[model samples]
Target: MESNPAGQGPALSGNVMFYKKPEPLSPEAHGSLGVKRIDQPLGFLRSAHAVPVTVSEFGMAAASFPVIFVGNDKTPVAVMGIREGQNLFVGADGNSDQDFYLPAFVRRYPFVFASDNQSDRLLLCVDREGPMVTDQPEVPFFENGQPTKFTNDAIEFCKEFERQRRATMEFVKLVDSYGLFEQKSVNFTPRDQNGQEGPQQKIADYWAVSEEKLNQLPADKFQELRDNGAIGAIYAHILSLLNWQRVIQRALRTPPPGQPLS
Candidate 1:
């Protein structure tokens, strides 16, 4: 078996490499919000596009609120909107007299929606996927634009979705901080060992062991292990999970409460 200078092996069979062509990075990529670029800021409101019928169906009525549409290099990733005044609230029947504050993150993408009407400003962050959603609880949703009541389980799912989104963002920041993808050279030789294969083989063995260990732990435990200086032992395992994508999708979905799809 041949080995690269870094002691890494050649492409293995059944290995699928998904490479995202580096986008033309902007200074915002390294901005305060983490690995995201805000090409535009809050300004003149654009003409309203087709509003999802689900908004009214869910009995979410708000006039002239700010909606932020988050996306990646592709299509719209998530939509978050916030409204103010005494009439905006999240009630069982989607009718109330309380001001509503809604912050959401798409589970499958690195996006977040933070809105406060008192401040009259909506803050949008990108590439900051985190565990905004998880297995703890469920959030309600409007079905077919009808104010049908949903179980707490539904609401919990929505919450978990956001939790997962934030978690993904944090994970990306962690990897970037390590500069793991930055190109570097490493040396490995079979002859270097006592008549054994080179560093590549050693790395492969280590990865195999690490993977097994990671698979056995639950999500929370796995994260704890990583926080406790077991990162290298579980890097490959966590990366394989692609947990970021899950959070992104969830964030993109229309959230419960009387908030519009911003």
Candidate 2:
């Protein structure tokens, strides 16, 4: 989540990461606005080191980047870099450095669902500040005051995302109830030109699913998790931790400010 840029309509609940100006979509407010392809559409991601991920993305994302749980909510996030405001995977051109799984959260950018507490319904909103959104146009949001196919498709994608988000919340609650989380730290030991190890630097501290605790659970409880289809996601999280070394290697290649390199 970042600072709320001045806008109209109901404010989005929870953390609205990467969104600067989110306004409710409407023919009156944004009929002229449309999305257009650009060279660096995802360039905004360069400053984001971690992005939220749904449970469904665990296995796919695990193979690409380290997925870790964070905050009191135990929100799942894919770690992209060891340092703040540094995304190792996103190059200066805003494209991924290599082929990898892109989180749905990132893909659903610009369009998001905001809860309307009063109406007890979800409202589709667009980030008026999104790079792709423009008035000059390519794919118009609306035609003849009705939402165009592009807008309708975006709505469907956002709806599915919301479903996954709710499921992720339930998964977090289940894991928390079982007391399966533990505090973990990421540390990196840099090397000098001679290949000698330097002092280890602490990179981040976050909550993670504890394999020990998980294994120690009663057989019945373990089976319950399995029956509930949570076992796969849990193991996926554990396996993803192994990729921390991969992230460290990337950091070394393009070391962050203040970090020494070999």
Best by TM-score: 2
Q: What is the TM-score of each candidate against the true structure?
A: 0.22, 0.91
Best candidate per lDDT, number?
Answer: 2
**Residues 1-262, candidate 1, lDDT per residue (tens digit)?**
0112222212221211111121111222311112222222211111111121111111121122222112221111111212112112223243222343222221112332233334443222222222221222132122333222332233344456546444544543443344332221212232321344334321110111124544665788667657744465234322422322332233234332354322
Q: Which window of 10 residues has the lowest lDDT sum in candidate 1?
A: 16-25
Residue 20 miss distance in model 1 (angstroms): 25
Model 2 alpha-carbon drift over 4 Å, by segment: 1-8, 11-15, 192-197, 257-262
lDDT of 2 by residue, 1-262 (tens): 1112234455546448888887888887887899999899889898889999999999999998889998888899999988898888987787976688889999998998887655567888888899999998889998997888988999999999999999999999999999999999989988776778888999889999999999999999999999989999999999999999998998878856446555
Residue 7's lDDT within candidate 1 is 24
RMSD of each: 24.9, 3.8
Q: How high is the lDDT of residue 11 in model 1?
A: 26
| True-vs-predicted CA distance for residue 157, candidate 1, Å | 1.0
